[model samples]
Target: MSRLYGDPIEVWTREGEPIQFVWRDRLYAVRRIIDHWVVAREWWKVDDDDPGERRFWRVEASPGQRLGTYELRFDTTGAGWLLVRAWEC
Candidate 1:
């Protein structure tokens, strides 16, 4: 199928499980849909007594609002989207 994209956003499964929504399309099968996602958590960091911080994720299949992934994060260099973080399962 062709690729799809959207603002990497958060979603919840019908069972209330948290899943990331990274894409949107008119495709549907059984378990999985036509959306990309990221199963992410908190990543804290510190250096030279510069305090500490964590990074959030908005992972996707493409980079922008197209057919791909987009990971918007926050950390030392701020946050933005990426072309692809890892391959979708």
Candidate 2:
């Protein structure tokens, strides 16, 4: 596993797969999706009005220079996207 951080970001998707994202003023293109899953809501931790299910993806990406693996997520209840974690190998 990689070191985790809660970094909110803007993402662009194609046919339900994330294709790119903007982080720290730079844009990175997702080269491939390694894995993906849906996280059910934690009802005990959040109110009913809070975001529902969350969809997560682990992907290999590049910012035009260096390659890295990143974990990104989308909230189904309309809270938008987030870059949850990242690492280079």
Candidate 3:
């Protein structure tokens, strides 16, 4: 089962890919990127000059123990990084 958690987190990226992140004062290293996609809801309503896309990355990560799946988002409208969902693996 997956759980939702729209919490803001600090993410470190390398070459446009997340390599590590800090959430709840715990550091989790991204072992692999399970999947990635971009969402632009109501694209027809968005202004041409506005950045409305939200990039999502589903990663397999761990903090030195059991690995877990985490979904992170980077909103182009300046909403920043958000830890969207999680699943224990």
Candidate 4:
């Protein structure tokens, strides 16, 4: 099972990809990026003042011996990084 967080976080990236992130005061190093995708506003809602496109990265990360699967989001309209979801390993 996974948990939804939606908490703002600080992320460090390499070549535009997340390599490390800090969440809840602990730092996690991304071991691998499992998936990556982008979501855009619907064509019909283009003028609805949406937050623009959102990019998501599902990654395998670890802080010490505790490894977890995390979903991170980047809002193109400048909402910044968010730790959206997580699954414990």
Q: Give per-candidate clash totals.
A: 6, 0, 0, 0
Which residue segments of model 3 deviate by more than 4 Å?
none
lDDT of 1 by residue, 1-89 (tens): 32334243333334432233332432211232344334333346434544434343433333333443233333333333322233343
Q: What root-mean-square deviation over C-alphas does model 3 reach?
A: 1.4
Please give the CA lDDT of all the candidate structures. Answer: 0.34, 0.89, 0.93, 0.93
List, residue by residue over 1-89, the lDDT tens digit for candidate 3: 99999999999999989999998999999999999999995856687788488899999999889899999999888869999999977
Which residue pairs of candidate 4 clash? none
Q: Write the per-residue lDDT of candidate 4 for residues 1-89, one digit (tens) a residue.
A: 99999999999999989999999999999999999999996686565666488899999999989889999999877869999999988
Distance from true location, Cα of 80 in model 1, Å: 9.0
**How many residue pairs in model 4 have overlapping backbones?**
0
- Using all chains and alpha carbons, the TM-scores for the candidates as numbered come to 0.24, 0.84, 0.91, 0.88
Q: Give candidate 2 regions above 4 Å deviation.
A: 43-51
Q: Best by TM-score, which number?
A: 3
